[model samples]
Target: MNIFSLEGKNAVITGGGSGIGLGIAKTFIEAGAKVLIIGRNEEKLREAKLSLGDNCSYKSFDVTNLDAIPDFVTETKSNLGNVDILINCAGTHLKKYAVDTTDSEFLQVLNVHLLSVFALTREFSKVMIKRQKGSIILISSMTAIMGMKQVVAYSTAKTAILGLMRSMVAELAVDNVRINAIAPGWIDTPMLHKATDNDLPRKTKILNRIPSGKFGMPEDIGYAALYLVADASKYVNGVFLPVDGGAAGGF
Candidate 1:
């Protein structure tokens, strides 16, 4: 049997309605995993469900609603059976200088990108622990490792993910639950488009840094995620894998 096969696995992917999350969900379905995607936008989720067909489903919920995550996880487990994979892909990015960012703005980013992730993972780990088999993949960013301007809150939240991934792996490995992170560099997602809209100079500067000489596609991250979530990566834990097209190596 192929170690990459996920024929009977059930994956719960947050933010799976669009962008990198959507890409990862699609890849998992193609690899024979049943995927449940959660996002705040009903329309996007509906579209994703349509595109993904019977093996994929969606739930409309804001991940930042930390108080409700345990209930959400419980309901998901009941509805979908055991969730063998948990992908924390929902995040918010506020592009503002540290000096200009308000407290609420910073907290809001942290709420979605960090706090909610921690809460959801904590809840899901119980289910995984009982099974003694699972994979948890967190979507981090290149900004987590490098200093980037006008994204103070986003960078901080992303950096926190590394620590979270490492700590979780340490505690969860005993239970046979693997935890890891992906730090993507400048993927061409809706968020990236929004960040680079009408800023040709900045866009050009970014493109020039990538050794691949092009921005990464969501599918690129998707394939990388597939490897991590599948049994192919059973021995890989607590590692921050960079799918950045050599951007990390360049700078």
Candidate 2:
């Protein structure tokens, strides 16, 4: 437990208004860390902060604004203290097929998932590098590895995340900054429900492929976040850890 304890650490999580982002923030606070969450909706962020209690606070800022990252990082540090961990979890899901997806749609997904991730990490790593310690985690997806239908843009962006992690880790590891990605399987979230409720066949296909035979909970990802952000994973870097319930490995 001591190794997993995030005592005295400061964390900033993007998309922390709900779903996996909020889940990670809750887990970090429980592990003894203070957290600052970022989101586009002020009301949602406020509700999340209330739910996560005094240890957690939030700011409203859409991560898709690549140009705003540097200023956001500066202001967050001036307000929230030095960031010891950063969780890049802000993303948009596109369920359209490759042939049907417009160029703009594809770019939108990339801008939100890929470019924003890089921009934020690069800016935050500058701060971490000077201090010589920090952890950067990316929330990738099962689409990164599996050839799932109707999510070409989403899959493309997620796969690119691993490359980004490795690229950044190569340079940051020397500064004691850890860079990693987490690929979550079919987690039970409202978003996932909406994505699948209308497509029963697609849902069945995903469930049948998963050996665990159960949908993953948000806390499953939270626990994985705990390990990576805490001292327990100080040696881990450039790894894409899957939090899927054996779905990525099953037939």
The most accurate candidate by lDDT is 1
Question: Mind sharing the TM-score for model 2?
Answer: 0.98
Question: Candidate 2's C-alpha lDDT?
Answer: 0.91
* Pairs of residues at least 3 apart in sequence or in different chains that clash in candidate 2: none
C-alpha lDDT of residue 128 in model 1: 95
Candidate 2 residues 159-238, lDDT tens each?
Answer: 99999998888988999999989999888887798789999998888889899788998888999989988888889888
For model 1, the run of ten residues with the poorest summed lDDT: 90-99
Off by over 4 Å in 1: none
RMSD of 2: 0.8
CA shift of 19, model 1, Å? 0.5
